[model samples]
Target: MILKTYRWSFVVTAVGLVLAAWYGLSAHLGIGQAIALVLILSILEISLSFDNAVVNATILERMSDFWRKIFLSVGIIVAVFGMRLIFPIVLVCVTAGLSPAEVIRLALAGGDPETPGTYGYELHEAHPTIAAFGGMFLLMLFLNFIFGEKEHHWIGPLERLLEKVGKLEYVQVIVAGAVLLIVAESFATEHGRTVLASGLAGIVTYLLVNGLGELFNVEEHLEHGEHHEEGAPARSNGPTPVARATGKAAFFLFLYLEVLDASFSFDGVIGAFAITSDPVIIAIGLGVGAMYIRSMTVHLVEEGTLAQYPYLENGALWAIGALAAILLISIEIEIPEVVTGLIGLAFIVASLISSIRYNRAHPEEAHAETAAAHS
Candidate 1:
C-alpha cells in the first residue's frame, strides 16, 4: 500500500536527487558535498512545509478525484517551475527592469566573485516588497481561519472566543488591514508607501481568489440543491458525485490552491538564499520537498487522517497565523528560517498529540464523529 500510494513521489525524488547530484558535479563540487547539500535542502524544505501539508490535506479531502489528480500532477509543475524557478526570475525582470534571459544569466552567475549583480542580491533587495505582499496575504489567511466559526475546537476557549468574535462580519479583514497598516507605517519606515501598497495588493488578491472559490462552491450547491447534512462525516466510501458543471468550480478551486501554495513558497524561496544562492540547487531541493508534500496530502486524504485527528487542521491554521506574524516581524529584523519552521512544527506536534489523547479518552465520541463525517 505504501509503495502504491507513494510510487510517483519515490520516482520524482530519485530523479530530483540525480539531477541535483549532476548539477553539483558540473559545478566542480565533490560528489559527497553535492549529495549532502541536496539532502539538507530537501530536508529543510520538508520540515518547513509540514504544516503546509496538513492544511493542504484539509482542503484536498474536500475536492473531487479529478481535482486531486490535477493537484498532484499540474500542481507539482507549477510549484516547481512556476514558483521555485520562474517566479524569482519574473520578479527580477519586473523589479530590476531586466529581461527574462538576463535574469536567468544572473541566477546562473549567482555565486561568481566578479558578477556585480547576482540574482540573489537583487532578490534580497526586493525582500521588503515580497515580505509585505506575502506577509499580508498569509496574515489574512491565518485571520480568516482563526476567526471563522469551527464546529470542533482544539484549544476550546481560544477557538470559541474567536468564533464568537467572528460573528462581526468582516472583522477579520478589518483586523488584518489594521495590522498591515501598522506594520507598513511603523516597521517599514523608509518603504512605508511601497509596503502599504503591496500589503493592500495582498489583501485584494486573497479576497478575490478566496471569494471566487467560495462563490463557485455556493453556485455548485445551488445547482444541485443539496446541502451537506450538518454533522455528516466529510469523508465516505462512496463520495457524492459532483455536478456536470463542476469544471468551473474545480477551476476556481485549482486557482485557490495555486495561490495558497504561492503564499507559502514566498518564505521558502527567500529563506533558501541564506543556505545557498544557487537557484538551481534551491529549485531542485525545494521541488523534491514539494513533491513529498503533495504525496503526503494524497495520503492524508486517502487515509481519512483529518477525520481521525480532528484538531490537526486547527493546529495547521494556528501555525499559519504564527508564520504570518513571523513574516511581518522579519521585515524589520532577520528571523532565522529555522525559528519560523520550528514554530509551525511545534503547533502541529501539539495538535497531533492532543488529537491522539482525545481519541484515547473518548473513543466513542471519535467513532461517532467519523461516522457522522462519512454519513
Candidate 2:
C-alpha cells in the first residue's frame, strides 16, 4: 500500500511537470530543455544525497511505524522549506543585510556570467565558507560513530539523567520555546544576527536532530555495542522480521533522522545559490532531491539492507557525524560540495562492499560476528 501510494505521487508529479512544460513551450521556451533541466537537477540532487539516504536508513530502521509516517511527511516539509528555502534567506539576511527578496534576485543572477557575483559575492569566494559548514557537520557525524557509547556498557548516571529529562513532556517544548526566543532576539540585534543565527541554528539543529533520533530509537543500536543481546531471539516458524522500534523510542528516532537530514542538506542549499535563484526553481530542485533521498531511505529499510551490510550502517553513521561537523564549520568557511559529497559516498561504498565480502567469506559466523560487535 505504501509503495503504491508513493508511486502514484511520483507519477502525478511527473505528469504535472509535463503539462507545465507545455505552457513553458508556448512561451518560446523549449519544452525539451525545461524538462531536461528538471531531470538533470533531480538526478544531481539524488546522487549527492545518496550518502544521506544510506545514513538515514540506518536511523529509520530503528523507528516505529508511527514516527516513520511523521518523518515521511513533516520531515520533508522541514527539509524543503525550513532548510532549503528559509535557511538560505536567513543566512543572506544576516550576513549581507539583504532581504529575502533581494537574495532571491541575486540567486536568479547566478546564471548570468556577465554579472560579477550572485548577491554581491562570487560562489568561489563563498566556497570556503560552504566547505567549513560541510566539514563541521561531517566531523560531528564521524565523532558520534567513533566515540558513541558502547551498548554492553551501562549508560550509567548520565543516561539515566537524560532519560529522566526526556520523559518529561514539557522538556522538548521548553527547549523549542527557548530556541524561538533566541531566533527572535537575534533578528532584533543589529549586526548580531549572524552570531545569533549560528547559535540558534545549532540549538534548533540539536533539538530536532537529536529529538528525531530519540523518537526513532536508532540510538538503541548505537548505545548497545553490536555484541550485546537484550534477550534471546523469538522462535517463529515463519521468516522473522527485524525488530521494530516503538512509542517514544520511535518518535525520537524519527526526529534524529530528520535532524541529521537537515544537517546533511546545509551545504547543498548553500551550493544551490550557484544555480538559479528563482525561489521556485531552487525549492523545486532541492525539494525533488529531498523526496528522492527519502524514497531511497525507505527502500533500504524495507529491504533489510542494513541488516545485510552492518558495517555500511556503521560507516554511514560516521559520515553523518562528519557532515554535521561540516555544517558547523560552513558558518565560517565554504567547502566545495563536490568534494564533501564524494568523500561521504566513498566511505559508505567502501564499508558496504567490505561488509558484503566479509559476510560471503564467513557465512556461518555472520550472526555471531554481528552480535559480538553489538556487545
Candidate 3:
C-alpha cells in the first residue's frame, strides 16, 4: 500500500518533467541541451539528496499520520521555494551589493562574456579559502555525529530544571532566536555573512512554516511523548493520537531537518558557485533536488522501509549528519562536493542493497519475527 502511493509520486515527478520540457525548454535552452541539463541536474540532485531522505525519514516516521502528510506537502514547499529560492537572495544581499535580481542575471550570463562581479566566487578563485570551507564543514559534521547526544530526555535533570522556570516555551524560542541573531550579526565579512545569513534563514524559515502548519491543523503530526515507542499498536479511532498531542515535538523535528538540509547543502551550493554563479541555476538545481528529496522521504515513510532496515537507516543518518558538518567546514576548506556525494551515496546504496538481499533470503525476517531471526 505504501509503495503503491509512492509509485504514483514518482510517475507524477516524471510527467511533470516532461511537461516542463515541452513548454519551458525552448525559452531557456535548446531542446537537446535542455533535456540533457534537466536529466543531469536531476540525477545529481537526487544523488546528493539521498541521505537527506534517510535523515528526514528518521523523524517523519515517528510523527502521527496527519503530520506526515503535511510534511509531504507543506514541507516540500518550504524546502523547494524557501531554501532553494529565497535563500540565495539572502546570500546575495549580504555578500554582494547586488540585489537578488541582479545576482540572478549574473548567473544567467554564465561567465561566458567577461563581466565584473558576475555569477561566481571572486573569493573562491583563491584555492585556500575553498579548501578551508570544505574541510571545516566536513570535519564539524563528522564530529557532531561521533560526539553529539542522540536521545531525548523528558524527565531528565535538564528538563526538570527547565520546568521550574515560568513560561518555558517563550524562553526556549527567545533563546533560539537570540542565538540566530547573534550568529547573523557576527558574520560581518562577505563570505562569513553569506554563510551565516543562509544558515539563519533556513532555521527561521523552518520555524515559521512548520510552526504555522501545526497551528493550523494542517496535519495531525505530533511528537511521541517519553512513554511511547513509535510503532506500538494503538486504538485506531479514539480522538486520533495526534489531535491530543502538543506541537513542540513536531516543531523541533522540522527544525532539525531544516538545519540538517542546510548544512548538507553548504558544499553543493558552494560547489555550484564553482560551476556557475547564476543564482538561477543554483535555485533550479537545488530546488529540483529539494523536491525529489521530499518525495523520497515520503516514500520511505509510507513504505516502512526504514523500520525494516534499522542499521541501514542509522548509517545513512550519520552519513548525512557527517555530511552537514563537512559542508560547514567546506566553507573554509576545499573538500570536493563530488567526493562527498559519491562516498555518501556509496554507503547508502550498499546498505540498502544488503538490507534487501537479507530480507529476500529470510522472507519472514521483517517485523521482528520468530527466534529464527538469528543470523
Highest TM-score against the true fold, candidate: 1
User: After superposition, which runs of candidate 2 have C-alpha atoms over 4 Å from their true positions?
Assistant: 1-9, 12-16, 19-29, 104-138, 149-204, 207-249, 275-278, 321-336, 365-375
- The whole-model lDDT of each prediction reads 0.81, 0.57, 0.53
Q: Residue 55 in model 3: shift from native, Å?
A: 1.1
Higher-lDDT candidate of 1 and 2: 1
Which prediction has the highest lDDT against the true structure? Answer: 1
Model with the higher lDDT, candidate 1 or 3: 1
**1-375 in candidate 1: lDDT tens per residue?**
678778888888889888878888898766677677767777888888888888777667657788999999999999999999999889888878899989998898776322458888788767778888888888888888777766578889988798779779898789988998899889889778878988899899989987886688768888778676776643211123344225666677678778878888888888888778888888988888888888988887777777888788889888988988887877788899999899999999999999999999999989986775565
* Superposed model 3: Cα runs more than 4 Å off: 1-4, 7-28, 112-116, 122-246, 272-282, 353-375
Question: Poorest 10 consecutive residues of model 1 by lDDT?
Answer: 235-244
Instruction: Write model 3 residue lDDT over 249-357, tens digit each, in one string.
Output: 5665565566556555545555655454444545555656666677788777666566566346545745654564454444445576677788788768776777666
For every candidate in turn, the CA RMSD to the true structure comes to: 3.5, 9.3, 8.9
What lDDT score is found at residue 118 in candidate 3? 52
> What is the alpha-carbon lDDT for the whole of candidate 2?
0.57
Worst 10 residues of 3 by lDDT: 235-244
Model 2, 1-375: lDDT tens digits are 466436733853575367437644764447775565556556666766787888777667656677777777888788878877676666666556667777777765544423555642543333333333343334434433343332211224653354445445555445434533443354324323443444445555555556564434445545543323566442111112345666666666665676667666766665665554344455566777788788778777676666666566666655565565455444444466776677778778877777877789878667765564344
